[model samples]
Target: MADVRLFPRLAAVHARRLLANPGISTGVDPDALRSAAEPFVTWAPSGGRRSTNAELDRLRDNIRAVAAACGWPGPAGQVSRASFDAGMGAFLLESGYLPVAEALRDDVWSWIAIALVPDVCLWRFEGAAPERFLGGRRNTLQRLWSRARVFDRGPGEEDRWELLDRLTEDAMVQITERPSIGADPKLAAAIGEAWVRTAAEVGASAMEALTREAVRNLRITNEVLCFGALGDADLAAAVGEHFQRAAAATASQTGQASG
Candidate 1:
């Protein structure tokens, strides 16, 4: 691995100032922002060859293009928000720079959120919580990257990323928000695949309940058993069974409510 760039731990106060800065207008000039933030950014600590300004500019240009395609700065983002999020996640993860260790650095993410793509962050969140701007649990891009990493079906599969677009927000949360389930990409993907299958069988109405139940069961199973030992097909089957049971439980509850 090589060293990557890291931005300082910018406080919420400063984050608010720049994110709310009206003078910059719709989008930001990466070079100008880079110059302003350069005094604070460093490359000594993280992995991957030292990040260059040129590499960073290329990344910025790619992300900007992706946003444009998704209709950023327009009403299209309102309707295609998920698409944009998934696209950004895929691009960031696939972009060659972020290794696991470097990817975990909140400073790096903060820099990206604060200086590199403040324009997108502001427009996307539209005055959401501070964590969305910072690099922690709810940080916009970080969370999306985590989710994309978890749900990605891996190389060689024709539609590997299909799960990224298929699962509902709530369904994604069931796997992603909980550390017990989200930490393991293989397990997460297995559960995601089961969720899609279960949705097809039981319909959308039961999915939310089924997802909750399935995740609950998986958490318990993970505590007692080694999920890592299981083969992909076996793991998917096991998760599918949990979802089946969840579907039954939800159906019974619905029947009781009707009665």
Candidate 2:
């Protein structure tokens, strides 16, 4: 766990300007991007440390190495989504919390996506919005770091990994973005398992509707309930009830439509 620092702040205006440029967005040579981005970065004074130019380069190298070891068979573009998820998840787990936290910042991640790994960004997010390079949620490295932070529930948690593997990309994004459940590991796992079970019991069409409804209901419940006070079983039961209601509603809708 190295002491991490904040990346020098790039004003929102400047950041948008950079992202709007066709050369940066369309993908330029990594060296050229780095040189262009260098002037905008200022290392933090203390508390956290900024990633240096050399450190960013090392990170890129490490990403490639990990991809290779994980049998990703890259050029980055060729890596399967599942393989990329697993490999990046493993990388984030090994990266420790501090670096991951720093990487979460839009400034740092923007630099990484736009300057360091633009090719990977373009490849992985082809035809996607520019936000893929500029936004925290869509940034390639930031999203992986976020996924690892939320789902990699630590030692003796192989079951968590399995649950994660079972999730659709849409499901993963949904669960990860929900602050009410995403911030709590127990809640996240319980909700995930419950969602999977509900999907199994009702099938995919119902599951999508159920998931959407359940998440909406849960968000409302979260406002009034102190979910943290509930034990694991209770929390799980609470989540299950939401899904059960959603399933029932979805079934009714389907029946009426068929009728």
TM-score of each: 0.83, 0.80
- After the best TM-score superposition of candidate 2, give how far the Cα of residue 79 lies from its true spot, in angstroms: 9.3
Worst ten in a row by lDDT for model 1 = 1-10
Residue 108, candidate 1: alpha-carbon lDDT: 69
Scored against the true structure, residue 76 in model 2 reaches a CA lDDT of 46
lDDT of 1 by residue, 199-251 (tens): 88888777987788889988998999878789988887888888888889999
Candidate that would win on lDDT: 1
Query: After superposing candidate 1, which stretches have Cα over 4 Å from the reference?
Result: 1-36, 45-48, 76-78
Please give, for residues 65-109, the per-residue lDDT of candidate 2 as tens digits. 655664544444433766677667767665663354566567767
Cα-based lDDT for every prediction: 0.74, 0.69
Report clash pairs, candidate 1. 2-47, 2-48, 2-49, 3-47, 3-48
lDDT agreement of model 1 with the native: 0.74
